[model samples]
Target: MTDKIVESEAPLTLVGGGWADRALLADLRRHAPGIVAADGGAGLVLASGEMPLAVIGDMDSLDDAARARIDPARLHRIAEQESTDFDKALRSVAAPLILGAGFMGARRDHELANFNALVRHPHRRCVLVGMDELVTLAPPDLTIDLHPGTRVSLFPMRALHGWSEGLHWPIDGLDFAPDARVGTSNVATGPVRLRFAAPGMLLILPRDALDPLVRTLLATPGAWPAP
Candidate 1:
């Protein structure tokens, strides 16, 4: 989507390091066509009974035996010690949507770094599928749908115009800033929908109930602003 070095996977599945997010893992397992392992994520893939299509990253976490177990052609063992393996994997593919698992269970610093990747790669249709919820960064005025009971959360990356509808308490006119603004955590009052008048916001939700959520979000249309 960004004209970068992304290989088309149409429906790609990215593997991260959060082992206990089974609900999210289950959802990704059901939906992803192929898997991309970030560093040591191959264990999750193997444990899940799915061989990875490609393993991209710095090769720090993988043992020689583990590396031997994976198909060599599928391994894109990037040795760039300067960046996180996650970032290396992100640059390697283009999928209409990339569903990732296991990215937030490590150190807080790693977790925050992964979070940064989500927003920075907004040019591609990607979603960081995780335990307890999902995350995606989008330009202002994006709409999202959630399963009737699915919980949703929104965090602003910056201060900008906020106009919302469908939340228990919708904001028609407001300015939200990352340092001092309150985000909206609400339920779907007849299918969640909202629009903003600026750029950049983080979206989160409770796991796979997003089938309907995605359906509702795309029921509108969109433009790509970043990657």
Candidate 2:
């Protein structure tokens, strides 16, 4: 995938957790070389036998050991409490593609809020990674490069109004409400190209499906929102 960290094999990113911090770090290192810790995530970074390029978020959650173990140059703390550590991690990294975990599964509010954050950012090339699936919001007025057999899900954060050129169930002139009218388990039709008149949100899984996804993006130009 274009957004993936390691290109040699299956590109994946592992996000460390506060509980399984040590275990998850090791697991990620074994699988994917690109692993990042957010705030308290440095704990696992040290134990993982690798140094994180950046340790992000406000210093509130970070402890003395986490700070001492990681280098100061790589650390970026956002004193803005209005934003979250997750947002800090997202902003700090320049990775065109991202894979994340432990971002969810902590608290209900944290999980739900993080999911919403993914929608809010709407990075043209990013994945809100998890144990189950990979997620990303589609760029406004653009096509999604996906494999013909790839699966997709369209979840409306606020209210969605758009149509699609290719998908198992192409939505059109439809108003999608949150928690309802959510699109899921859709099979890709050729290269998935979604031309959205208005900005909208969408999720995708790139495993066993990323090949076509990359090819799709190669042919289609990306969309940029009006500032």
Q: Rate the local accuracy (lDDT) of all candidates.
A: 0.68, 0.61
Pairs that collide, model 2: 3-97, 145-213
Cα miss at 142, model 1 (Å)? 4.1
Candidate 2 segments exceeding 4 Å error? 1-36, 141-150, 206-220
lDDT of candidate 2?
A: 0.61
Which ten contiguous residues of candidate 2 have the minimum total lDDT? 3-12
Residue 182 lDDT, candidate 1, scale 0-100: 57
> Against the true structure, candidate 1 has what lDDT?
0.68
Off by over 4 Å in 1: 1-6, 20-26, 139-142, 147-150, 216-220
Worst 10 residues of 1 by lDDT: 212-221
Please state every model's RMSD to the true fold in angstroms: 2.9, 5.7
**Candidate 2: tens digits of C-alpha lDDT, residues 1-227:** 35322233333353534334455445434444576667776766666677776677777777897788777887777788876677666655544445566675467676666766666565534555444455566666556556577777777777767778778788777678686787767777865666555445666575444434434433545554422
